[model samples]
Target: MADKTLTSANSVLLIGVTGLYTVPQQLQGFSEDDMYSMEAVDTAELKMGADGVLSAGWIPQIKTMGVTLQADSDSNTFFEAWYAAQEAAQEILYGFGSVTQTSVGKSYPLLRGVLSSYTPFAEAKKTLQPRKFQIKWQTALGVPI
Candidate 1:
């Protein structure tokens, strides 16, 4: 029988920042939708000429990655602190991170990542909602471990 692949077990997401948070730590406190999602901002644009000619222009854009975690997660607190430090810094500090799916032996790395957007906090009457964090990354295709 062929080897059974395609598993999410033993996957981890880690983040780090220079001078502030140099050590990369695993981000926990994830919600049910804990999978990290990545999407390309734009692909290629194509046009057809009147004389039945075709032209295409490929635009290289940053990839946007998003993750959802519980509001009360320690990971959220770490992110908040990281953001605060960035805001208090004299210069911008980009984040360095990586996500590895050990089961598949595939890893996605973020060379230079910017925390594009995130919800500080949100709460209902007696319930805590999950917070979403979006990151803009300049990443290439996933490589083998």
Candidate 2:
């Protein structure tokens, strides 16, 4: 008998893309940072209505993505990206997330999106801790994870 393909996996997504915010990730390339660690905890969700008599339909009005991008590089690449956008008063460069499951060897594609916030901070009075930036992305398509 043939073996069944396993479905279990790990690592929701890795966000390390850069370039024009309005452009898709296909145009731009994901950054190559050895120390950077990017992870997506929350994926696009259905814009459902409040609990009602009937079950909530799959009519997702808006889809969004939330990511946690962390890096220990002192070069300030993260800050520079946000600073450039802020200085020009334009939308910042977005990322194209690749949701992958190592166990199953499957990959899920996520649309590009802009960062919700542009502030990276470390806990005050902390001893040698890397700063984690919590950013949100606005995507129209739903994520398949």
Pick the lDDT winner.
1
Query: lDDT scores for all predictions?
Result: 0.79, 0.44
Which runs in model 2 stand beyond 4 Å of their true positions? 1-55, 61-66, 69-76, 79-83, 138-145
RMSD for each of the candidates: 2.2, 7.7
With a 3 Å backbone cut-off (N, CA, C), the pairs that clash in candidate 1 are none
Candidate 2, RMSD to the unseen true structure: 7.7
What TM-score does candidate 2 get on C-alpha atoms?
A: 0.47
Q: What 10-residue stretch in candidate 1 is worst by lDDT?
A: 1-10
Q: Residue 106 of candidate 1: its Cα lDDT? A: 83
lDDT of 1 by residue, 10-105 (tens): 778998876777988799878775656887567888899999899999987788888788877888976787678878884657788899888777
lDDT of 1 at 13: 90
lDDT value, candidate 2, whole model: 0.44
